[model samples]
Target chain A: MSVTPALDARREFESLLEPVATVAYRVAYNFTRNAEDAMDLVQDSTVAAFRSFDTFQKGSNFRAWFLRILTNRFYKSRKRGRVETTPIDEAEDVFLYRQAARAGLLGNDDDPARLVLDRFDVEAVEAALDRLPDEFRDAAVMYFLNDFSYDQIADVLGVPVGTVRSRLHRGRKILQRALWDVAKQRGLVHGDGPEGAGA
Target chain B: MGTARRAPVPKDMSCAEVFARVQEYLDRELNPDEVEAVKAHLDYCPPCARGFVFEESVFETVRLKLAASACPEDLMARLRECLEACDES
Candidate 1:
């Protein structure tokens, strides 16, 4: 019966992971657009999580812990492959808000967010998210899509909470631009050229 | 005539300041004082308020939709297998 504790530990991990597995995979897939790579990431991170189970606090946020492992592994692998040192995009935040305002899209009493939301479906949102650079895209997906709190995102990304805040701020601005362009291409909004040139 | 309470300075948290921190506000990352300041600005600023609504909706609508999506069935099976292997090992 020496294996009983280990077995129980495994079972507990599995049970905890069950509910978050899909989300974990989704997060991984968003990190790596390929399915196989995503699966490998999930498995690798899950196995890592299993090994580090003892360090995990039982009552605390297991999902965040596991996702931290997943994201750490991902960043580590990228480091091993090649070092990418791009500066964070520090462009004006709320690109869409400005664009909408210029296009008179925000002039109406209509819900601007709803107006934006109605223009694009999930796939379009995903596409727009995918277009973001690695740093911003990861934060955007984790926060907006994966529902990670700023704390969890900071832990997962191995950055400070302030960095997470900036990344999300910039990421969202970039996403707004992406969404605006996509909507225009689809004719979802009329009048004014891209980036509000006409308006 | 009844005296009215003083109106907000309108300069307290200008539209620019509110816009700069709107994401934090929407994410509920602000402290009480900060939240109140942002709220005061939002109250008087219709355009900023509408922008806040729009920004909030973008995160919410997308989050809800993407959250409902599950991984592929085969991927789930593989992940389960992964757990089983780890358990046995």
Candidate 2:
């Protein structure tokens, strides 16, 4: 069944906005790591998406298309000095590693004690996330936490699907290695036990 | 004393290869053969297993933290107001 041109376009646009808005906000939050910045980015992206509604092709993945707009807008405004940049590097890594390690060491991970300490280590993970490079952290959080698929991520970032896969693959590896190192140092995992220095 | 030559995990079995299947593993998207391979590798290789565990934990932690940091009532209200303003313009 063919849809009436104007009516179909409007309906399509509205439908797209509902689901995409939440995803956009989540992605923005991951990118900015601040409520105010995320809110602004979402708002700006929404308006821009509405303005360019005609350019969006029907039956295409709207979520990715809209996200690409949001990401571009974010970087443009960021370049214009609207958003603050958090430089992530060795210094940030060292700080986060130390913090998580100390936190892990102090938290009781023993069987019975773990029941009480599970909540505390979430903060440690957050600190580790804060240490990641902005793009890696942003993409990782969006894909893993927000549940956007690889194709959607590619569309959002205006890159090829392979690039998204590589970014996520690399981003996850770095995060996993960092967290494991911290966990090992903190004694969260018994490396020297039957697991034997790796587990 | 000669250095012990560790058995190779197949150069094809780099951390990247193991990690690529991780999401699939978590989502139960892998078929039997792939699942078996990943599981077998994890069983013998503590480092890879630890890495997987770490990845899982990070995902869990981020999910929890994001849930906890949901936009407060006032913040949501403010965001709605801003959205409405954008609509009017």
Candidate 3:
């Protein structure tokens, strides 16, 4: 049996790719918000990654390196132009904590974060994540889903570290607001007024 | 109840300043000095500490919830097949 350079490359690529395949699929799903499209994206990205496998530096971060390719494929295949910005609001930075404080839920008896988490099942939390603008959602997913550092996220998103910081800052605020609205609609928490108002 | 003696407020960092960097603190983006500054403030202020805990808990909850999604078997199979095909061509 001849072990050619091509065969060696294939084995190495497979070994590296298998571990990250699940994460790649999830990232694609977050991008497409559809299973079939996500599959296509993952497939396309995997094939592309293999063809250029030699370029991947050894002993480097394989996940971030592969995700850079996957994210590029996602951006290129898009017919719709990416939305780079969301309108900045005068919203409080820690909106949920503030809301919980005003509603008297931050006392010794009540853990506001636990209250929100207990009320929102995984599906509800994911739905709230889906409601964020694409840029914010992508940043939040990259950071929260895989524990990617801000610098790693910047490398994957192809932005400056500062941009990643701002996106996460805004993304957390937006996610909190969405969670608050969903909880209100479901009557999970009783508030004296709407989200921003004192309860 | 006896009045509790709190550590004097950190001179370099105010509550507002600590709050502003709270997200970075949670995300571990702050450098050591910045983190120490934020920690100093949180040590003295119970309200600020509670706020930080709430933010951290929310982030941890979301992380665990989102990571619970498993990649479907069919997608994994197709991905494997694509790799095999790449080897052939």
Candidate 4:
């Protein structure tokens, strides 16, 4: 198909790039699980998106379109094999929910600490996220963490909407378990028996 | 173990179900009946309530962390280089 002139397309793409960069980085980080990989993914996706700018329908979700390209690139590069999946057992699931509740209760809106990240073990949570399988992790990061709607996530992943929901559900379950395990070990949470012990 | 535990909630509402609907509740997407069900469940179940709390916290944490970890100076230079190369071709 005939496309916009290269210079004009580049200008338009440049204008859209900055606003979407943070979201793109978040999506790439979730998929690749490393800063280096995420950077490469964003760069490659940007180039590819710029080249195909003609097909990108105007007035549509640009972030989702760009993410779809990035996620597709990620899977293509993974032709070697799929990552190992970590399953969350039923007991761990229950404990995770309980701990999440307690954490919520401790921090209130009036508390200044609530607004800051000082007390929370963000590093621990990030560590747990790093261990998730690529698909679920990417889905969770894009949908929940990035604040994309389910339809947006589906568009970005180029998957059916139902698959997006399924990945998010499974991903959240895994994260809940992982976060509990990490927090319990670090003593960030109390009264939750050792990870997997209560279950 | 307490009066809250003894209260009756809808049989359809399990922790998983409540967890799934947490996002809906936050977004105000739940209908009156479903909202009531989730509210009643949250009222009785500490774990489910905690789970929602953690979810919100993690969500905020992820957002802040991502924002803080912007494209580094070197990465921005590299990106500029890549764009320049693309323009040349």
Candidate 5:
């Protein structure tokens, strides 16, 4: 029945930590592109977080504070990765939809967003992200995956919101191109609507 | 086609402008007038409309896919152990 303050605090910390761990791991994996490495990063950062936990203001943003540590470790240990700045024209896949519409493959009945969901899996999506440079990938993961606001992302990335916006914008274009190809290759382009895509 | 009478894109928002700011529009980063301009453009521009849909899907799918990946049990155990060690220190 002898519970120390440290043990009680540990219990409190773990309670808050458990829910966000999955997301923290996922974000770490995105950075390292290796589960083992991601685990290491998370383990190291969690230890760091615990040491500094006393300084953490109650009711402040734990997720953001912890993520900043994780990202800092990643930057320290991670090798340089490529980040693409695709030309606006090359990044867009509107031609595919336009072609689908013209061929009657996609008509009023079809929802392109729904189609995208059905076509791409987690691996395909991750591969596309891998193609992005490290900074853009981090921003995209934070904004899209973690649902961080642009300002939160900027805070984590140590940049202005404008930078986060540009990175996300560019990241989306690359993803669109990659995802469209997956959809086509999966034979989802059957143009099965009342209008014929091939016709 | 009743839509044939309409212009290809919004008179106010050019294709270039829409293309440049499409992410901002989707992110709700645009102002009221700017949002209206993008909306108007989307109505008339079929390609941009298609692009917009796919972009939306990509955004949502990334969130869903990544969020679905849970931390491995071993890592969680390790983290707990690490924190326990911190308590002892």
Candidate 6:
């Protein structure tokens, strides 16, 4: 049948994408934060992937390959939506930092990350992540969600590795502050009447 | 603030140096000695320790949350149909 090659192509595409579709969709969803846009993004990327399947090297990681396409689509659409801008939370940042310090949370030997892990739940994590600016959040999300290495994230985002590092660093600080707030609200930790009024 | 506490960082490691490398250290990209330096600094430096803990926990949180998530079935179906169109075209 004339359709055999096309069917074979479709089959090949399906086989490659099926396993990672959920992840691909999730990545797109992370980018768009809207299911409909995410769906469109993934669908469009899928079509693009199929169209260019011939270029994909066999035995290469399909997740990275397809996701590179998916992310490119997202980046293209968002070029107009949000430009790279600096974070404007200096006052709030100092407040959060001092709060964590004042709460006797900073100097302790206890795992600060554990407070978030054991006390807060997934929703809180998502909320905290939602508050990050797009530049930092995308790298952070991709790093955490897909277990992408710094190098892979850099490659996918098409930026320098240093940029990925900075985003993760900044993103982690924002999330740490968010998690500290969560702990305080739950009374998981409380103020210890300040840490000698120091930094 | 950090300038005062960092006076005795062994091997000239400053608080800024230790904290700055937290992400790379956690990522295991640091050299063995660098990792030891961070661990050493974390022992006495609560701020960096706490920050490290928070960052570590962030990794754990993501792993936990992603463990339970799945793609909606209809989206998967929709994706397949989208590919089917490629077959026709």
Please compute the TM-score of chain B alone for each predicted structure, in the order given.
Answer: 0.69, 0.60, 0.72, 0.58, 0.70, 0.58
Clashing pairs in 5: A82-A133, A83-A133
Chain A TM-score per candidate? Answer: 0.78, 0.57, 0.78, 0.72, 0.79, 0.73
Real A-B contacts recovered, model 5: 0.56
List of clashing residue pairs for candidate 6:
A113-B53, A113-B54
In the order shown, the candidates' DockQ scores are 0.29, 0.16, 0.33, 0.17, 0.32, 0.33
Candidate that beats the other on DockQ, 5 or 6, i.e. the better one: 6
How many clashing pairs per prediction, in order?
1, 1, 0, 3, 2, 2
Q: For model 3, how does the per-residue alpha-carbon lDDT over B1-89 read when each residue is reduced to its tens digit? A: 11223234355887777887888888777777788888888888988998889988888887877777757877667877888888787
Report how far residue A159 has shifted in candidate 2, in Å: 3.6
As for TM-score, the candidate ahead, 1 or 3, is: 3
lDDT digits (tens) for residues B3-54 of candidate 4: 1121244556988778766754665645678888988889999757766675
**Candidate 5's residue-wise lDDT over A1-199, tens digit each?**
8988888888888887887788898888887777788888888889988888999999998887888777777778774334443432235434444444544555454565555455567776676567566666788877765677888877776777777777777666665555555555576554433322221
What's the true lDDT of residue A45 in model 1? 89
lDDT of 5 by residue, B12-53 (tens): 977777866766777887777777888888898977877677
Docking class of 6: acceptable
**A73: Cα error in model 6, Å:** 0.9
What level of docking quality does candidate 2 show? incorrect
Error of 6 at B8 (Å): 16
Per-residue lDDT for A63 in model 2? 74
Instruction: Rank by TM-score, highest first.
Output: 3, 1, 5, 6, 4, 2
Best by TM-score: 3
* lDDT per residue (tens digit) for residues A1-199 in model 6: 3667768877887988988898887777667777777788889999999999999998999988888888778788873223333343422222344555566555544554454355566665565566677777888778877678988888878877777776776776665555555555566666644422221
| Model 2 regions lying over 4 Å from their true place | A1-23, A52-68, A79-117, A121-123, A180-199, B1-24, B27-36, B39-58, B70-72
**Candidate 5 C-alpha error for residue A171, in Å:** 1.6
List, residue by residue over B1-89, the lDDT tens digit for candidate 2.
01223233343465556655775576564567777777877887865665465445546555665545455344444445554565556
Position A106, candidate 3: lDDT: 64
